[model samples]
Structures are given as structure tokens and as C-alpha cells.
Target: MKLYIKYMVSLRCKLLVRQELEKLGLHHISIELGMVEIKEEITEEQKQGLKSNLAASGLELLDDKKSILVDKIKSVIIEMIHYAEEIPKGNYSDYISEKLGYNYIYLSNLFSEVKGITIQHFIIKHKIEKAKELILYDELNLTEISYRLHYSSVAHLSNQFKKITGHSPSFYKKLGKKRKDTLENL
Candidate 1:
């Protein structure tokens, strides 16, 4: 049985889910962000127990198809931003559509309807969060960060950063505050 889970966006989440499954004595085939597959059919009691355990850890098992699709979209974006070494070449909408096997408009509309935020805004928010992380690491300058994130220029990055964060990249860096949202929350 394949279970789609919400808020399973990080390594810790995967571990937590694995632990819960083990505690329930359920054998899982695989555990991935936002989804898991179990080898054996589970009893209703086991399913309820698993759901309760997951909920205690701030995760929810999704049954609705739309909700599952939305979670899939989120997992893909989070993976691209936080794990992928190199940004894929091409427009994000095209990439997302191709990856999800759906039209970009349909995905965008579903995302907006479900999340109350546009997909573009979600990407921009995550990008800004990533920018903050890069700035704090002190590994790359603003120019390098911009180039790495596919921004047109440092000015463009700064402008977007300022718009979203209410602080310019330089100022935010100087502030030295590492205020970051969890991946699931974002």
C-alpha cells in the first residue's frame, strides 16, 4: 500500500516515519518524501495507529487525490531547492509540468486553489530562503549567489530579497540572524 504523507519534507521526517512504521511492526518497501509504500496490507487498526503516530509528529496521511497531487508538487520543489546539486535548465513551469505530467496552468490553478498561494510565489519564497542560507554561510558573494540561483543580476536578487524579506541582501547578511522556516512550513 502506498501512503501519501503531508509535511514529510526533510530527512528527519523520513526517519520519523520509518521509526513509526517499525514501531508498528509494518514492513515498508520504501520511504520517500511525501510518500511511502508498505509491503503488506495493513489492518484498519494498524492504519489508524500509523495515522495517529504520524499526526503526533506533525504529519498527516493524505487520501484525497488533489491533496496528494499538491503534496507531490511540494516535494518536487523542495527536492529541487534543497537537494539537487545543479538547477535544471529550462523554465520552472515547464520543468514542473514535465515532471508532474500535467499542464502548467492546471498545476498552477490547483496549487493556488489548495494553498492560497501562487506556485511562482512559493518558488520565490523558497529561493529567498535559499538566498538567506547562502548569505549566512559566507561561502559565496551576492553575485555568485545570484548566478547560482539563476537570477539575472545581483541587483535583481537584491530587489527580490528586499521585497520578500524587507531587507536588502547586504543588510540581512550583516544582521546575522538565521531566521529560517522549516521546509514543511514553507
Candidate 2:
């Protein structure tokens, strides 16, 4: 049996889900970002127990087809942006469509309807967040960060960073460093 989980985005979340499944005596054959395949079918009682346990931890066991598809879309985006070593080359729409085996237009429309934001906007938001993380790490300069996030140039990255965060990348880096320094002093 395959189960879809919502909000299971992080490694920590995977661990929690695994623990939950074990507690229910269910054997999971595989657990990916948003989907899990179990060795055997679960009884209603077991399903309820797992569902409530997951809910308490801020995750959800999804059943609705539309919701599942949306969660799958989100999982793909999160994996591509936050987990992948490098962003894929070429158009993001094509990448997403290819990954999900759906038409880009259909995915875009569904994503917008469910998420109240276009997939492009979502990707940009995640890319900027990744940029912030890289900046705070103090390893990559703006040019490197821009290239890592697939931005056309530092200028383009700077524009989007400022637009989304209301601060330039340099200023944000300085601010993050200062905050870290202050925390260390305390």
C-alpha cells in the first residue's frame, strides 16, 4: 500500500514517519519525501492511529487525490530546490512537468489553484531562501550564490532578493553575521 504524507519535507520528518510506522507495526518498504510504500495493507485502526500520531507532529496523512497531487508537486519543488546538489539546467516548467509526468500547463494551473501562488513564484521564493542560506553560511559570495541558484547574474539575484526580503544580499549577510556574533557573545 502506498501512503502520501503532507508536510513531510525534511529528513527529520522522514525519521518521525518511520518511527510512527514502526510503532504501528507496519513495515514500510520505502519512504520518500512525500510518499511511502508499505509491505502490507493497514487496518482502519492502524491507519487512524498513524494519522493521529502524525497530525500531532504537524504532518498529515493525505487521501484526497487533488491534495495528494499538490503535495507531490510541492515535494518535487522542495527536493529540487533544497536537497539537490545543483539545480537542473533548462526551463523549470519542463523539468517539473517531466518529473511529475504531467503537462506543465496542468501542473501550473493546479498549483496556482491549490497554493494561491504560481509555481514560478514558488520556485523563486525557494531559490531566494536558498540564497539566504548560502549567504549566512559565509562560504559563497554573491556571484557564486547567484550562479548556484541559477540566477542570470548577481544583479538579477540582487533584484529578486531585495524584492522578496526587502534587503540587499550584502546587507542581509552583514545582518546575519552580526546576529550570529551577538549570539556567540551571549
Candidate 3:
């Protein structure tokens, strides 16, 4: 059976899930972002145990189809933003659509209804968060950061950064590691 997981967006979460499965003596075929497939069918008691285990680790097993789809969407976006070395070419809408096998309009509508934000807004929020990370790392100048994030220009990046963060990237860097929101929060 394939289990859909909520908030399984990071490598640490994957490890935790794997550990939980092993603790339960379940043989998992694979565990990817937001999902786990196991070779054997799980009993109700085992499912409940697994769910509680995951809950203790700040994850949830999704049952509803709509909720599962939403989790999948979040997984894809998180992977693209936090893990990918570079943002993939082409528009995110197209990428998401192709990745999920849903039409762009349907994905946008579902995401907006479920997330209470447009998909574009979600992408922008993640991009700004990534920009902050790069700023804190101090390895890349603002210009390079802009280019790395696929912003058209440094000014555009600065404007968006200021708009979202109420401070320029330079000022934020100087402030020295102000708390950043977790990826799950974003």
C-alpha cells in the first residue's frame, strides 16, 4: 500500500519516516517526499501505530484524495525550492502541471482553494526565503543571488525582497541571522 504523508518535505523527515517504519518492522518499498510504499498490506492496528509514530515526529498520514494531492503539490514546490541546485527552466505553472499531470488551471484553482494563496504567491514566498538563505550564507552577492534565483535583474530582486521582508537584502544580511520561517511554515 502507498501512504501519503503530510509535512514530509525534508531529508530529515524522510530519515525519520524510515526509522519509524523500521521500528514497526515494516518493509517499505520506497519513501519519497510525501509518500511511502510498502510491500505488505498494513493492518488497521499497524496503520494506527504508524500514524501515531509519524504524528509524534510532526508528520501525518493523509487519507483523503484531495488532501493527498495538496501534499503532493507542496512536496514538489519544496523540492524545487530547497533542494534543487537551480530553479528549473520554464514557468513554474507549467512545471507543476507537467509534474502532477494536472492542467495549469486546475492546479492553480486547487492550490488557491486549499492553500489560501495563489501558486504564484507561494513560489515568490519560497524564492524570497531562498534569497534570505543566500544572503545569510554570504557566499553570493545580491547580483549573483538574483541571477541564481532566476530574477530578471538585481533591482527586481531587491524590490521584491524589500516588499516581502520590509528591508533590503543588504540590511537583512547585516541584521545577522534573524529567525527564518521553516519550509513547512512557508
Candidate 4:
């Protein structure tokens, strides 16, 4: 059975979730961001125990189809930003649809309904977050980062970053305060 989880974003979170399942004597076949597939269906008592334990850690087990779809979309974006070495420049709609094996319209509508935000907005938000990460690492200049993320130009990236974050990328880097969002929200 595939179980959707909230806030299972980082590698550390994946390990933590794995540890929690082991503690509860649950055998999981695989674990990934925002989800896990267990070897067997969970009993009601086991579900409740998991719900309580995960809630204490600020994670929730998701059950509904729409919510699960939303998590799947978020998971794809997170993986792309955090792990993918390169993303091609093109219509991301087709790319995401192909990657997730769902029609773009279905994914977009479901995501907006569950998240109260458009998928494009979510992507932009995460792009800004990735920009922050790159700038923090000081591995690339603003222009290089802009090209890496396939932004039209540095000006465009700066404009979008300022609109979402109320600060320019350069200013954000100067302040050096780490801004972040929860994985579910991001």
C-alpha cells in the first residue's frame, strides 16, 4: 500500500520516516519524498498509531486522492530542484505531464484545488528558493544562476524573486538570513 506523507522533504526526513516505521514494526518496500509503499496493508490500529507518531513530528498521513495528487506534484518539483542536474528549456507543462504520467490539465486543476495556488506559482516560488540556495553557496553569480534555472535573464529572475520575497537576490544574499518554507508549502 502506498502511503502519502507530509513534510518528508529532505534525506534526513526520509531516514526519520524509515526509522519511525521500523519502530512501529511496519515493513516498507520503498520510501520517497511525500510517499512510502509498505509491504502490507495497515490495520486501523496501526494507522492510528502511525498518525499519532507522525503528527508529533509535524507530518501527516494523507488519504484522499486529490491530496495525494497534490503531493505527487510537489514531490516532482522538489526532486527536480534538489537533485536533477539539468532541466531543458521548453514548455514545462508537457515536461511535467510526461514525467508524472498525468495530463497537465488534470494535475493543474487538482493542484490548485488542493493547494489554493497555481502550479506555475508553486514552480516560481521554488525557483526563487533554488536561487537563494545557489546564491548562498556562492558557487555561481546571478547571471550564471539565471541561465542554470533557464530564466530569460538575470533581470527577469531578479524581478520575480523581488516580487515573491520582497527583496532582490543580491539583497537577500547580503542579509544572509536563511528564508525557507515547509516542504508541503514549498
Candidate 5:
């Protein structure tokens, strides 16, 4: 049985889920961001127990089909921005559509309806968040950060960074580690 979880966006959440599964004697085949596959079918009582336990830990066990799709979209975007070695070089719309096996139009509409934010806005937010992390690390110059995040140019990156964050990247770097957001919150 496969289960979709909302707000399971970090390694910590994965560990918590695994622990809960073990407590219930559920053998899991795999646990990825926002999802888990168990080796055996789960009973209703087990599902309820797991759901309650997860809820107490600030995660949700998803059941609705639409909610599951939305969570999958979030998982893909999170993985792409935070975990991938490099952002793909093509249109993000094509990449997301291909990854999720849905038409871009449908996915965009569904994401907007469920998330109350356009998919583009979400992507920009995450990209800017990543830019902040790179800036704080102090290892990469603005130009390098721009290139690493696949921005068209430093000017383009600066423009979007200021637009989303209300400050230039340099200012953010000056402020340092005090302002970074966790990946789950983004």
C-alpha cells in the first residue's frame, strides 16, 4: 500500500514516518519525500493510528486523490530546487509536466486552485530561497550563485532576488544566517 503525506518535506520527517511505521509493525518498501510504500496492506485501524500519530508530529496522511496529486507536485518542485545537483536546462513547465505525467495546463490550474499561488510564483520563491542559502554560505559570488541556480544572468538574478526578497543579494549576505527559512516552511 502506498501512502501520501503532506508536509513530509525533510529527512527528519522521513525518519519520523519510518519510526511510526515500525511502531505499527508495518513493513515499508520505500519512503521518499511525501510518500511511502508498505510491503503489506494496511488495515483501517492501523491507518487511523498512523494518521493520528503523524498529525501530532505536524504531518498529514493524505487520502483525497486531488490532494495526493497536489502533494506530488510539491514533492517534485521541492526535490528539484533543494536536492538536485543542477536545475534542468529546459523549460520548467516541460520538466514538471514530464515528471508528473500531467498536462502543464491542468497541473498549473490544479496547483493554483489548491495552493492559492501560481506555480511560477512557487518556483520563484523556492529559487530565491536557494539563492539566500548560497549567499549565506559565502562560498559563491553572486554571478556564480546565479549560474548555479540557472538564472539567465546576474542582472536577471538580482532583479528577481530583490523583487521576491525586498533586498539585494548583497544586503542578504550582510545580514547573514539570521534570515534563512527552512525548506519545509518554503
Candidate 6:
């Protein structure tokens, strides 16, 4: 059976889920952002146990379909932003639509209604977060990071970064403080 988990947006969460499954004697197929697949269906007591364990760690075992869909959207956006090496080609809406098998307009509207933020804004936030990571790593210069992330130009990237962060990318890089995304935001 597949399990949809809220707040399973981080690697640590995945590890926790994996450990829980092992403790429960469950066989897992795969564990990805906001999702888990196990070979066997869980019993009621097992469900309760898992739910309690997950809840204690600020995660939820989602049962409702709509909630699952919302978490799926969150997971995909997180994957695209945090794991994808380069920005996808074509329009983001089209890419997300194709990825989720939902119409872009409907998904965008639902996301905004449920999350209280526009999909565009979410994408921008993720982009900025990714930019921060790139800058901190110092593996690539601003121009290269911009190009890799499909930003129009270094100036545009810096402008967006500064707009969101209230500090220039160079300043942030020099400060070397951690830039992190909230779990809900990711």
C-alpha cells in the first residue's frame, strides 16, 4: 500500500519513515518526498502506531485524496527545486501540468487556494532558495548559476534574490550564514 505523508519534504524525514517501517516489520518499495510505498497493507493497529509515531515528529499520514494530491504537488515542486540540477525547459506550468497529470490552471488554482500562495510565488521562492545554495557552495559563479537555473541573466537572478532576501547575493555569500526553506514552503 502507498502512504502519503505530509511534511516528508526532507531527507531526514525519509530516514525516519524508513526506520519506522522497519520497526513495524513492513517492507517498503520506495520512499520519496512526501510518499512511501510498502509491499503489504497495514492493519488498523499498525496504522494507529505509524500515525502516532509520525505525528510525534510533526508529520501526518494523509488519508484524504485531496490532501494527498496537495502533498504530491508539494513533493514535485520540492524535487524540481531542490534536486533537479537545471531548470526544466519550456514553461513551468506546462512542465508541472505534465508531471502531475493535472491541468495547469486547475492545479495552480487549487494550490493557491490550499496553500495561500500563488504557484508562481512558490516557484520563485524555490528558485531563490536554490540560488542561495549555489552561491554558498561556490562551485559556480553567479553567471553560471543563473544560466544553470535558466535565469535570463545574472542581473535578473541577483535582482530576484535581493528582492526576496533583502540582501545581495554577494553579501549573502560573504556572510556564509545558512539559508533555509521552511518545511511548509518547500
**Which candidate number maximizes TM-score?**
2
Q: Candidate 5 on 1-186: residue-level lDDT in tens?
A: 899999999999999999999999999999999999999999999999999999999999999999999999999999999989999989999999999999999999999999999999999999999999888888999999999989989999999999999999988887775444444367
| Residue pair clashes in candidate 1 | none
Taking the tens digit of each residue's C-alpha lDDT, what string does model 4 give over 1-186? 989997778888888888889988999999999999999889998898888888888888988888888888898888877778986577778878988899999999889988899999998998899998999888899999999999999999999999999999999987764343333356
Task: Give the Cα lDDT of each candidate.
Answer: 0.91, 0.95, 0.90, 0.87, 0.94, 0.89
Q: Write the per-residue lDDT of candidate 1 for residues 1-186, one digit (tens) a residue.
A: 999999999999999999999999999999989999999998899889999999998999898999999999998888887778977768999989998999999999999999999999998888899999899998999999999888999999999999999999998987774344344356
- Model 4 bad stretches (over 4 Å): 177-186
Residue 106 in model 3: lDDT: 85
Pick the lDDT winner. Answer: 2
Candidate 3: pairs in clash: none
User: How would you order the candidates by TM-score, starting with the best?
Assistant: 2, 5, 1, 3, 4, 6
Q: How well does model 3 score by local distance difference test?
A: 0.90
Sliding window of 10 residues with minimal summed lDDT for model 5: 177-186
Model 3 alpha-carbon drift over 4 Å, by segment: 177-186
- Indicate the worst ten consecutive residues by lDDT in candidate 3: 176-185
Tell how far residue 50 is off in model 6, in angstroms: 0.9
Better of 4 and 5 by TM-score: 5
Better candidate number, 3 or 4, judged by TM-score: 3
TM-score of 6: 0.90
- In order of listing, the candidates' clash counts read 0, 0, 0, 0, 0, 0
